[model samples]
Target: MALLARRVRPDDWKPIGVDALEANAMKVVVSTDNRSVIAGPGAGKTELLAQRAAYLLQTGMAPPPRRILAISFKRDAATNLAARVRQRCHRSHAGRLDSMTFDAFAKGLVDRFGQALPERWRPRPDYELMFPNDTAFRGFLFQDVGTPPKAIGSYADLQAISIKTFERSLLVGSPLPVMGWPDPTVGQWAADRFWQSSLHEGKKTFLSFSMIGRLAELLLRVNPIAREALRLTYSHLFMDEFQDTTQIQYDLVRTIFLGTDAVITAVGDNKQQIMRWAMAMDDPFSAFDADFSGKRTPLYNNYRSSPELVRIQHVLAQALDARAVEPVSKTAATIAGESCAIWDFSSPEIEAQRLARFVAAEMKAHALGPRDFVLLVRQKAVDYAAVLEPAFRAAGIPLRNEAGTVGAVMLQELLAEEASELLVKVLRLAMTKRAGRHWTECQEALGALRGISPEDEAAQAIFARELDAEATQLSADHPEPPASKADARTIVDDVLGFVGRERLIAVHPAYAQGGWFEKVVEAAAVHLHGSSAGAADWTEALDTYEGLYAIPLMTIHKSKGLEYHSVIFVGLDDGAWWSFAGDQVEATAGFFVAFTRAKQRVVFTYCAKRGARTKIATLYGLLSKAGVQTIQIA
Candidate 1:
């Protein structure tokens, strides 16, 4: 069967690529039962996505009553595609294209069918949705689950697994238990209660991110009218970055559109699915054969990287897993011929400094700016703030750390000051009577304020040397001269008012963008048991705001779906890249994703000795076996 556009002529559409694979994939969009395009890095997947939207619109395949919906993993990605469709497609046909992220689409469904939602999740006047940060979630989990194991000290892992299990159970309509729990019944009970409590705590009602996908899937599965309305609402669905799709996300799509007239186009490269930590499975199309019986297309010609770099990527991928059989031929021009190397260093700090100097020199030689280079890490460890930041500044290199974890961690460090701890204590005492923390938490903050640790006494002597005698005497060890609620409010107002006017707001102009003030308010809210409010504010400050234009230093996960002219990947040691778990397949996949992000040059850096041994990193050995030549710097 040949697919044809309904209302537009052949001249109206522009060719996406000259390659036969890309053209065949586009035509299979309408002619086949369903299509799954496995596109590699720089394989023009974005162009194919845009052209497919234009084709469906131009062909009249998606009329006004039956619109086409395009969903992506990130908001910026969806916005980019929407912009492309508007510019490339005809003005009249562009209106039928609905482009948004999965979360946005789920929110729309919830708003449309509020009554059909589960009773626990039905919409209310004061209902608010919140995607809480790690700090807030950990605080809430501590309160619910009590103090965690001393060895663990945090229930973040448990909370994450519970949430994943909770959402998946809602999708499949079965009570699936989280593994490793001693008693599944008790674990399930606590998870259910936590889920309910997270929705409504006191007068504030906050919605978690997982609930959106779960409830939307539930509504579509249970409500006949809602199902039919959705089935008739969209004619075709195009999902990009399908490899990063989670189980709940996949289940939701399958629940809503299966056995319907919707044409689905799921496009992603299996090798690039590096979000396994977030519960994204290996096979994105695992259910396609059973559900849609889709036809699979692979695009092997990479139009993004140089030929030299492309060969290296192939070796890295194959070293991980030979079954990962998507070899790509480079179709892009080489900017700097064969600019790839592996640098060796004795210490991590020296390695960072050398990277900055190298980047500065590269910019001068290649006519590039700071933005043209990227320094990538496997994880955002303490060195990102301690070593990399100062190293770049010392070299007069304009660099910005794009990893939000670093910003959040730095904020916590700033708040750890003695003067800041006093302000937090005052806030905790003031909020005690309302929606605030427990009395024990208030007492703990007061103790830290009254009796500073031996490590903090030096900073306290400088910042809060002139403390009130009355406040200093009210320590957790000795609670004396108790103050009333009015006194506490006055103390909070005085302390915060003083810090806001004197310390935080009066920071040097150069350091104002460091988010000191935001962190102060957030730390106060967290200590005072108003973390919900703090979570919203802190998340907005980190996620909503963009850093200055400079070289981006981020983790490999953050660098996914993004490319640069020059890339440097540091920390290739065994513990950082390949753990003791012996999962080289997953490790190599991460390296492959990192290597493919460079358009021209790539540099790998590793320390020869982690602590004492002079053993090289296992990744270096793997690459050597793969026949990769490294210009090592001793």
Candidate 2:
């Protein structure tokens, strides 16, 4: 019964490369029992997780024919961790690990145990996998509903409602017993109906990402053979970003591993539980306490930020009623500069211009590159240009927006309000590092929007002319080309004005109404910010962009597990950054994550008035309450 009963010596068990606290964490990691580690930001949790997987195999804590299943919320993280295990551990031990995203793991289960699945949940052998784009998801939500409910304002609102409903019914296993026309019950019923339609009504069966857990849970709960297969296959289960694990995901994991000899380790900062709507429980480790007899392991050393920045975060965390883990950085003494500050502007436009000048000047003073700096916002608003473009143009800085930069949007989605997104697409194609055939690939993807054939010689000519391919070629040899940003902007405008206007309108009749062309210039700035790569390219692009000369503008969520030389938290006004939705636990946790992303310098910016409303910034008050003083710049 004792898995690690033939315990190795204390020195033999110590991890090869780790500090004191990390060594302590590594011991907890390899334990042949359940563990719940509340690893704060910069606690080296990622490394610890990889080491844990390695230790399980290397120490013989887990025997042969019993693999370790490591799950991450992001596919990239899963892949990265698996790579680390292979590099750090012996070849024989590393081969016993299977690392993948939760969705990927579930899909594998469904594929391997399809015959064991119940009739209601099983899919056809060749069933197609369809992930609905943003446009498609919105269309599905409003499809049969006669009148749009007042409660549902936009795609975002409807998405939140749908996720919460699914969590309550499917994940929590508690269907609200109500038959109201406009309630959580109605939303659940509609979502259930929509899912059923995909299973039975359509000739071609499509299983969405949302269906992965449902099908897996059903199979594990009903089929003994499937459960035994899982138990035999994996003796250890490790989940990263456990804070975001949903109810159905938890159930599936529990069904297969709990009460078995499998050792489970759930590692994440509960304060970073930003996905509360989709999660089954408010506390991330509730199931660990109730279902598994797990010991708590807390990793508190902060390695990413300076001492002053860590102190500031601690104060703010306490005020926000969060888990105030004391952050101590061993290397903090080497980092320099003011750790935090507040900058208040009269209006959003002025704020943008000032931020631009400040960034440009600071870069020169600090001898830092553009990538060392980042601007964090909640989401890309329709009016993102009004506040973002002024600073970019003034500083002559080219940028990349990583959030929601997914290509392959529906053709119908390119008209009227989102004409700017099409311009963004064009700018991305122009800025891409690809040349020749690779460059043609970018054009081919965009060609779908305007009905232009990718291989058409005429369209190619227009693209070459619009992008000023000749000038770019000439400037390529120059060490420092003059007016680089300006030239790029001109090229974007000239090409879009020449070809996009008529071609786009011809495809969508509604575009002929005008006013959309005015947004083309605004959309050009978007190209200055984000990448054209698919959404799955976040981790790789973010890593490359951080080291590149270009600046980054992204949402707080994307900034997780990432650090920068300088981080600017913008748009921190009341009802904006700290909206009612975030007033509680999850949002505060997100704020904590954002504040800790800087190692040397941290800047906080807010506008007094956004449009007509005078704003109240919640972060300022919370920090003030915590006795953290900040130098406010006018």
Instruction: Tell me, by TM-score, which candidate is best.
Output: 2
Per-residue lDDT tens digits for candidate 1, residues 562-629, read: 78888888776654654524565566677778888898888877675643212335556666765656
Per-model CA lDDT versus the true structure: 0.61, 0.62
Where model 1 places Cα greater than 4 Å from the true spot, the runs are 1-7, 10-12, 16-23, 28-32, 118-125, 130-187, 200-202, 332-338, 390-396, 405-549, 578-584, 609-618, 630-634
lDDT of 2 by residue, 509-552 (tens): 32332233344444433333332233233233323323255577
Error (Å) of candidate 2 at residue 278 is 3.0
What's the CA error at residue 35 for candidate 2, in Å?
Answer: 0.4
Q: Which of the numbered candidates is closest to the native, going by highest lDDT?
A: 2
lDDT of 1 at 213: 66
Model 2: how large is the Cα RMSD against the reference? 12.6
